[model samples]
Structure formats: structure tokens, C-alpha cells
Target: MNRFQAMAQIMAILCEGDRIRKGSQKYKIARKLIAAKIDRMGPEAAYSKAKWNKYELFVEIEELLKAEKAGKILRNYI
Candidate 1:
């Protein structure tokens, strides 16, 4: 699959809410990261026609986990 599709799938799987509640700060953080990556790679139109480079554009699942953990900690402080 292409980067966009892969990204969507990954987000769907990992996005089980943050440390606190559903659709909390972690969800927003994940969405922002996804959006930024998509924007960096151009636009949605390119996702379909763009040549696959062994699925390189998508963020690693572990990274998202780490982001969620960090966000949780930050949320506790804030």
C-alpha cells in the first residue's frame, strides 16, 4: 500500500486514546503529526500516484507510542 493508506491504517490501529481519555491530547498530537508529514510530502493527490519507496514516508509505530507517552506526561504537568 501507499504511504497515505499505510498511515491511515497505522493511526487507526494505534489510536486507542491517550493515557487519560478518548480523543484527548494524544489524539490531537497524532493527527498533527500525520498532517505535517502529509503536508511535507506535498498533497493528497500525490499519495495515489507517488512511487512507493518501500513505505518510507510514514512514521514508525514505536515513535507514535513514544509521542503518546510523552504527551501524557506533559498533559499531567499542564
Candidate 2:
């Protein structure tokens, strides 16, 4: 998959882990770690500008899952 698709997969995995680990401090810390990884992958300014859009993130997650189910290796998205 392409860079955007890969990153979306990583983010979706992180989100799932966060949901599974809810109510623990580890989940909060993992979220920050995932956010930092994403920030490092792209232009920080652009990422910061779009980071508040939850709907976009959700859509990206859906796309990522589709990619994953199609037998695409998406670990590079991280």
C-alpha cells in the first residue's frame, strides 16, 4: 500500500489497542506515542492543522481495514 494507506492502518491498530486498553493509563500513553509517530512521518505543521478532524480519521480507519483485509501488508504505515 501507499504511505497514506499504511499510516491509516497503523492509526487504526493504535485506536483498537486504545479501545481494548481503556480505563488504563497505558492507553493514554499509547495514544500519545501513536500521535508522535504520525507527527514524525509527515509535515508537523500540516498534521497539526488537520489533527482535530475526527471524521476524517474514522474514514481513514475504514480504508485501512479494507486494505488489510485485501492481504496488503501495512506495517510500514507506522
Candidate 3:
């Protein structure tokens, strides 16, 4: 993928629910961006970047999943 796509994929993986605040509108938007990028790059490639360990990426995926779950229940809109 290109640089923008690459960065988007990385951001999508690295972001956490706590960072976005689960109940906020930002959380809902971030969740969608994460899902789209993860779908394009595949979760493995999206989370695993240079110098990052597999376990770390795995943790990121877990966090993304949590964000996804929280986003589903959240009703806020941008």
C-alpha cells in the first residue's frame, strides 16, 4: 500500500479505546477507520510494524476489538 494507507493502517491498529473515550463521538469514528484499514491491510500487517513484537501487535488487536465492541453500544454521532 501507499504511505497514507500504511499510516492509516498503523494508526488503526495502535489506537486504543481509552485514547478515544468509548462514549464519545470520536470513538465511533475511530472505530470505523480502524475497521476499514484493518480490512484493507489485514490485521496481521496492520498491527505488525518495524521494531514491534508480535505480542505487542496482538495486544493492539485486542484493544481495537474492545474499541469495536464499545463503539457498537455507543450512540454518539459526529
Residue lDDT tens for model 2, 1-78: 444554455445545635425544444443444455556655443244335554455454555556666777656553
Question: How high a TM-score does candidate 1 get?
Answer: 0.36
* Cα lDDT, all candidates: 0.47, 0.49, 0.51
RMSD of each: 8.4, 9.7, 10.7
Q: Backbone collision count in every prediction?
A: 0, 1, 0
Please list the residue runs of candidate 3 whose C-alpha ends up more than 4 Å from where it truly belongs after superposition: 1-18, 49-78
Which 10 successive residues of model 2 have the least lDDT summed? Answer: 25-34
Off by over 4 Å in 2: 1-51
Give candidate 1 misplaced runs (Cα > 4 Å): 1-7, 16-21, 42-78
Candidate number of the best lDDT? 3
Candidate achieving higher lDDT, 2 or 3: 3
Worst 10 residues of 1 by lDDT: 49-58
Rank all candidate structures by their TM-score, best first, as comma-separated numbers.
Answer: 3, 2, 1
Error of 1 at 62 (Å): 10
lDDT of 1 by residue, 20-69 (tens): 23366555655555555556654453343223422332343235557566
lDDT of 1 at 67: 56
- Every model's TM-score: 0.36, 0.38, 0.39
Clashing pairs in 2: 6-77
